[model samples]
Target chain A: MTAQQTLWSLKAGERCEIIGYDTTLAEAYRIRLMEFGFHPGERVTCLQAPAFGAPKVYQVSATVFSLDDDVAAYVQVRLEPRDA
Target chain B: MSKVILVGSPNSGKSMLFNRLTGLNQKVANFPGITVDVGTGRIQAMPERTLMDFPGTYSLQPISAEEKLAVGYFERALQDPEVDHVLCVIDATRLEKSLLFTLQVIRDCQRFGKPVTVLANMIDVLDNHGLELDVDGLAQTLQTPVVPLSGRSGKGVDELLASLRNPVMPDTNGAFANAPDALLRGEAHALSRRFGPGGELLVRGQARLDSFFLHSVTGGISFFLIMYLLFQSIFTWAAPVMDAVESSLGWMADALVPLLGNQVARDFTADALFGGVGAFLVFVPQIFVLTFIIGLLEDSGYMARAALICHKPLRLFGLTGKSFIPMLSGVACAIPAIYAARAIDSPRKRLLTYMAIPLMPCSARLPVYTLLIAAFIPAETALGGLIGWQGLAMFGIYFFGMFIGLLIAGLVSRTAEDRYTDLPFVLELPPYRMPGFKPLLRNAWNRSRHFVTKAGKVIFAVTMLIWILGYFPNYGADLGESWLGQVGHWVEPLFRPLGLDWRYGVAIFTSFAAREVFVGTLGTIFGIEGADENMVPLVDHIHASGLALGSGLALLVFFAISLQCVSTLAILAKESQSRSLTLKMFIGYFLLAYVAAVAVYQLTNALVA
Candidate 1:
């Protein structure tokens, strides 16, 4: 299988589509992810990543929100190559 | 009186709208047993009716404790015969995201046969972006009358008020109560696309700024600098205003001193009004400043980012990033800090946050700390006079309080069964807007006033009781011979293990109302001891008493850790909705403080000997 890219794999100016959430994560986290508009097929762009391995800001359509590295890791994403 | 409910998602300028509608007439009450604040304001235009502002929630699907409270209030309001009209505040910048709650409210309102008006708030947000919205088209689609207005600028507030005057019943024939959330979201997206203006240009502008704010290196530096300034402003900046307020109250007391014919009347007014309550009121400027700064962070949409910065470190202690704001503000006053905990989404984290807050070295503790340091710690300068011994001791005490708070939070958050069930970290980064000064300041003033009135009422009463007990029998002549002194003698044994005398016991006992009362209480006790003559400087009194250095240290430790403030307990009880938890925390912290104080006293006493 081809390698999977998570939200944490992206940096500032990088963009990707949310493939789906890691189902093995807690149910509450999944609900929050959806509530935050991180549903599958939604396009998202990485806005900024702070120095600490902390929450990174991302924008989807019009909504901008921060996702922690752990939670961001749960969201499977298809990323554009760095050279693209 | 008719009931008007204001419902909106978080950060929809719902509060600004409430401020515009109600002004300073807002009264904050607890929701029965819950810690939730129920703010009701009299509509000045229609004095017969009252407006109720609920906690901001995204949907009726109550995931978080805050959402549960908001939706719970909405449900109960639906059954209330008084609640007839609803105002659904929607952010104009993000109509699609807002419509979910808007539609949810409309459907529920339809169920209850109540009319609804769509308050398209923050229109100025759109106006600045040079975008235009077809308000009529959007209103037509939703079958609700949408009144476009900026809650910040108050541009269309008159029109919004006019709409509220004749509340229009929405033709919610198309709304379905059981419509799936996904369906609602899809419909909302479609509705925004069809009728609302395309508006990501403003949001894109926000991205340019977020790059700097959310940059790893610069963000961390900025966060520390802002927090440093926050604490500095609370201390150094508010000093002049605090001194002014104190002197004015002193002047008033002096003016009243001669007017009262009897010594009893003069002492009562002077001590109770001028000394006890006045000392507490002097901290009011700090509270105002604290709330204003927090309000600025909140309105400018920087709070979420602040939370993000603290998320990782805080999570180690079982708290989310959101708890940081409350924790920081806790350094100012735990009353507002407890209220600020409302912003935290997770119940467990919020509870733990409450546990950590009172332990924060709030400004109320400043008087006690300063007095103790002046009496005990030598005034030698260190680091080429950059830091005085007193300043260093003050820093140590403040650090100790916050340290204990973090330790408690870490322990509490770690041991919980559902520790990992944190609601996903998805704090919204709303586009930055210039903070609306009028509304923001109005909000800070109203909250500060509410604190003074509600919390102040309890403080004033407690102060009066302390004053009365301290004054009677000998009529301020012999405090040791007075009733309060007797109570002090009674509690003295309880504290004697820490080498404290009955006089210190009196100060400690009276300070249960608040920590700052320790100074005034001790002052009066010492005043009685000083040959019934002019009161000596408190530091000189302490020196002459030949009190053990260990006992001074013990008192500092006790005040640093103990949850002594009655208003804090009252707020904790209301917010936690568990009198048992409040009782448990009170007894537990007091016992903890006592044991710690005793240990410190013994250790130091042994070493000094």
Candidate 2:
């Protein structure tokens, strides 16, 4: 699925599993995500989406990180439905 | 001696590596036209060596003037025959992005024909992540000798040092063998094209981090909490050490007093030297502790997180996310904070941030705040032992600094020319890694030494000057009859409504050198010898002198907001490159201080009546 489909379509507080990174953007960013343990198969939780569609705050493991809309738009994840 | 310059992104552990190479031989100097510190140190690498820890930057490309200086230095060093090696430090955990800069360095080395070495720092962190690098593969790929060393654990330090001692030539062929597609094709570029090829990488790194960290709200909150913890830690962990310093000063004063038989000499020794200088000295422990923690956060790459976090709030103040790094540094000392503002691209905004930074209640303000708050506000527990009102009051004063900072920033932003649309908040959140102790200790020691050496000299000289002023005209005859006493009396009418005596006025004036001097100034004015607990005696003196509570409250408010330190002002002037801005900052702050104090005192008096 496209990055926009995964991040933008997901509701706030939704949990998702990282599928992989879309490497079309800068390699530095892709590597930075990898270094932060945001690899495929890791669970990620959408914490907050700022008003007027600002940056999104996500909880990856115990650490809280904020992603700008552009970066958020490049991260690909599979949304975990509420039940599972 | 051959000189090697260590350069890398912020939090890449470059300083840590620099310490490993240089030990305690490092000194911090300002790059011309900017406030960022360039740490230089001499290392004895098998008969001859010197290493300079350049200010951390994302790329060689210049975005702001500071990056330009760093890139400029890198190029100048390349051309200078005195410089022999360029140690390109990379955070191995974030090697992909780091390699991008490394490739640029290789390109620079090619252009300048300077020998270079790749240091894959934080190898220990990679190990912890269950990741291992093919150092040999990376070295071959980059055509450079890669030394996998952890600056924290001392692991591979000897090997790294050995490499420095016996330098190796960078393999020209492998240098750009593994360059990313964009860099190789020259497709992606940084905003620093204004400076030509020299600044491209630097601008790219900054742009990348700026996009993520500057505009994000969550990033802002996270930044606030990190800074809040940093400030909170200074108050919490440093207390015991600060108390020890206070006790030591008391001991020294007691010991010195008996040796000096003359009353004037005795009082000067106890009150002026020990009392004035000693009070400020007590904060050394807190300063060292805070500096150490900040160094760790910076070395570990968390400081970038802090900058990113505060970006949103800082932008409101006409500062970029990068401005928060310097402002956070300002908590320790405004000198470095002003320099840290070099990362901000906009000249006007940088000047405003630099001017307003000193207003933040730095560690120097702690002694003043502690003394005043102790005298005026009763320490009361509130709401099921969840909080101490005294602690809350202290926090409120700190909160007041931030509140005023934002208000001033917002006001300034309205009047100042909008240099550019707000820069994107893009920050690469570097992976969390453990900081090594040796580098941490070295940094702490170096900073503590600098504070004691530089700030201490200024404070010592200023204290002596103020002491001379307050001491002469025979205040010993009867404090009421002294020159300082007469001066205080002259000013007393202005302050009488606030319940302050001439002594309080003198103390407030002396505090302009450094805030903690107020404690000693009060001690000298009151002629109370060997009182480590100066607040009680001070309060008693004020109460017996018949000053109203309204005046006490007014003094508290004045101390809370007044721009009291000359060093802070000097730093502002140096950073902003505008004497008028510094003067305006002082005037604006002092005016606000007077207004706030007067209003608080009058209102409190009215409410009490």
Candidate 3:
């Protein structure tokens, strides 16, 4: 069995296909994640960290949202090809 | 005579369209993430109908307070036969994102047998970018009446109103399964691809700017700079206007003095009317500037990011990101600061945030601090003559008060009972837009007027009581010979250990209603005691009193922590909504202040000797 890489593993300016929420998370948090298009198969790209803190900006398609490190770590994702 | 409910995802121009139709201005925030305030007004075009504007929400599943409120409105509106139609306005530019909510509203409205229309707002953007939307095609696909309108310019607003006059219910299948955690992404995606205009340029433009603004390095620096500018303007810009207001009040008070025959009436009219209300009125400019700047920041869609940036540091102090704005707002005044705490999602965090606000060294404390600093702290330069000693003292007092607030927050979080529900730190970052000034100015004006009226009444009553107390038993012959003086003498022993006299005790007692009242109360006491020909400046009176440095320091510390303002207490009672919590804060802080003040006074008395 392979361990899944989460959105937290994505570095600055990286892209990934969101696998969905980590099942261990509470239902409210999971629902919120899905509500903002963080559901399975959505293409999410990490734009950058706000330079100082744990919260990083990610584009969930057209809408961009910032997630704290604690919560960001729970969003499972598959890494996409690096920009040439 | 049916109620037309305006519902939409936040910032979809729903409020704007409602405002246009009703000709009533609601607070239209640029920050779409904020909780919606239910605003109902009569529709100008259709006088027989009432229009209700709800908070922007994505779906029936509630997340934030606004969402909860909106969903509640939806259910109650369904129950009430008065709710005839729903105007679900969606941003035309972000159709793919908004269509999810649009589908939900359409489905629900149809189930309830209420007619609904889809106002595809921001259609003006399509015209500018050389783009076209298949409006009729979207109407056909959703089976809902779709009107391409710009809420900002009122473009195609007549078409929307005409449709509202005779709302044709959408033909959606009403098969939206009432799933608690429904994932409609697949359906929303299919709808967007079918009917969405593919407004890629706007999203791209937003991405380009967001990359720069949310960049780690630049974003942090810009956040600090903007926040600093915001606080700086509150202090510097407001001073001149505050002075102008104070002087005009004085002029009014002086003009009325000769008209009154009785000395007691004259003093009552002068101090209670002019001094009390005037003092509170002077703080309005600072509040105005703070609200304006905050509105601008919120409208620009940076408030959430700013809160996110603040989250890490605030969490260290046992607070969430939402506490940042309210805490910063505390520097200007705490009433609005208390109201601002509504943005916090967590109950515990909101309570913790409320505890810190009162100790934030509000602008009301400014006059008290300045008066004391001018009297005792010499204007000597320190640090190789670079920094003024008095200025440093002022800064120390403000920072020290904030330190105590943070310490209390940390303690509360540690002792607070754990909740079963784990409230997540999920914050919504709304897209930025140019704020409308008409509503922003009106918002600031309304808040200022509200503070003046609500808090003003309490201050006025308190001032009159103090006036009546001081005027009695001698008919304004002598303040030291009045009922207030007798009470002052009785309470003098309580403050005796702190080395303060009965007159100081009297001043402090009156000040319990409002902190700034200490200065005016003391001034009136001195004026009657000396029975002077001219009114002496309160600062000069303090200078002549030969107050011990230890006692002065003690009084300063007391003012720093004391739950002295009744207006703040009234606001806290309203905000916290728990009588126990409000009382606990007031009494708890009062005792903490008393002990701290006594300790400082005694320790200083020993050290100085």
User: How well does each candidate reproduce the native contacts, as fnat?
Assistant: 0.60, 0.04, 0.36
Q: What is the TM-score of chain A alone in each candidate?
A: 0.85, 0.84, 0.86
Native contacts recovered by candidate 3, as a share?
Answer: 0.36
Q: Over the stretch B1-609, how does candidate 3's per-residue lDDT look in tens digits?
A: 788888887668776678788876443322222233677778888889888887677667765454565587677887789898888888887676687787777777766778889999989987887777789988886778899999888899899888987878644445453422264656776666677676457666777777767667777778789988987877788788888888888888888888999876787777667766566777788778777778788777888878877888888888888899999888777877887786676667888999999999987777788878877789799779999988998999999999999899989888778641235676656667888777667767866776776667777777678778887978877878999999999999999988889999998998887787777678777774322222337667777887888888888999999878877886677666566777899999989998999999999989999
Model 1 clash tally, residue pairs: 4
lDDT of 2 by residue, B193-242 (tens): 11111212332343344444434564566556777887776778788898
DockQ of each: 0.62, 0.09, 0.51
lDDT of 2: 0.67
lDDT of each: 0.81, 0.67, 0.78
Per-prediction TM-score to the true structure, in the order listed = 0.88, 0.71, 0.90
A1-84 in candidate 2: lDDT tens per residue? 553355544565688987866767566666445433455677776655545454455655323456665566777888888878
- List the candidate 2 regions with Cα displacement exceeding 4 Å: A1-84, B122-233, B261-263, B296-402, B417-423, B489-504, B514-553, B566-583, B598-609
State the lDDT at A25 in candidate 1.
72
TM-score of 1: 0.88
Clash totals for all models, in order?
Answer: 4, 29, 2
Alpha-carbon error at B563 in model 3, in Å? Answer: 2.9
Output the better candidate (1/3) by TM-score: 3
Better of 2 and 3 by DockQ: 3
